[model samples]
Target: MLRALRTAALGMSAQQTSVDNTANNLANANTTGFKRATVVFQDLLYQSVQRGGEGDQRPAAMQLGSGSAIVATQRTFLQGSLMQTGNSLDLAVNGEGFLQARRPDGSVVYTRDGAFTLDADGRIVTQSGLALEPDLEVPPETQEIQISSDGVVRVRLQNEPDALEIGRIEVAQFSNPAGLRSIGANLYEQTEASGEPQIGPPAEGGAGLLQQGFLETSNVDVVQEMVDLITAQRAYEMNSKMITTSEEMLQIANSMKR
Candidate 1:
């Protein structure tokens, strides 16, 4: 009964974590370039009761698992659907890769978001003012800007007959993208597990091509998340029932001793 109680308690705890992960996914269903996460669990160590005996023809050892635990929360990197905004500055990636941006402290971060705009200094930057890596600068008197599929930036100066090439956008990749650390505002930093970033132009080395006037929508599927939420709720209830039954069994045993 005691073992049953402990196992049931652990089960309930693990289910709670599942519920939390599902909730987060649903919450960010509409967030741009958002990726959902899933919970991973593992059974705890087993307790041996009896060893096998060859002479006695015993089949195998008797054992019982102590419990289960949430081992990790893994982020799913499946591509999200692209949305068309038709805005000149909006950008979207069509395949694998991330855009590199520099924070205020000069630390670099990678993101899937490409909704960019020009800052006060005519520098292309994210909404939070983080400048794009490689530092693309548009002329103050530019009338139109264009980004090629290979990430080449060009602009047409006011009253100019031809467009002039400005700079190229760099895309970064990782060996294990899920290992990157999330620091909010749809930004992620490289980690040891993720390996060093591979910087290059788009449409090269598995990096995605850039799409102007478009943005990537969150990958979360509301219907699937709802189903997961229901499953987790049912599992939690079952674990609670197991704990109750274990307690009742203990109570009955104590009454018999009277």
Candidate 2:
């Protein structure tokens, strides 16, 4: 009965983690460049009840699982739908890649949110003021900014009929993007599991092409998340019932008359 109580409690805890992950996904359903994460569960260590003899015809062992645990939360990197914003500064990656941004601490991070804007100094930066990697700077008197599908940045200055090339936007790819750590604000840091970033120009070397005037929407599906939430709730309830029944069984055993 005690083992049952502990196992049911662990099951409840695992279900709670699942619910939390589903809630986060639902909350970010409308966030730009947001990816939905799914909870991964693993069975806990098993306790052996009987070990069969070497020459016995029966099974080698009889075991009972302790419970389940939340092993990892994996983010789905599937491409989100692209929404056209008509703002030249807004960008979207049409394939597999992430834009590099320089954080406040001078360390580089990866992101899929390309809703960039020119800061006071005419430097293209994210909403958090983090400058894009490679440092694209526009002239003060520039009339128009144009970004090509190949990540080329060109600007037309005042009274200048010709467009001048400024700089190029580059994207990075990882062997395992799901291994990247989320630091909020649409930024991800590479870890050992993610491997080193492969920085290159967009539309070349397996990198994704850039789309100006567009932004990638979150990949969360509301209906799916709702289903997962319901499933988690049901599992949690079942575990709670199991714990209650185990307690009742213990009480009955203790109340026996001799």
Best by lDDT: 2
lDDT at position 47, candidate 2 = 82
TM-score per model over all chains: 0.96, 0.97
Count of backbone collisions within predicted model 2: 0
Which residue pairs clash in candidate 1? none
Off by over 4 Å in 2: 53-55
> Candidate 2 — worst ten consecutive residues by lDDT sum?
51-60
Among residues 3 or more apart in sequence or in different chains, the pairs in candidate 2 whose N, CA or C atoms overlap within 3 Å are: none
Tens-place lDDT per residue, model 1, 160-182, is 99999999998999999999999
Worst 10 residues of 1 by lDDT: 48-57
- Highest TM-score model number: 2
Per-residue lDDT of 248 in model 2 = 97
RMSD of each: 1.2, 1.1
RMSD of 2: 1.1
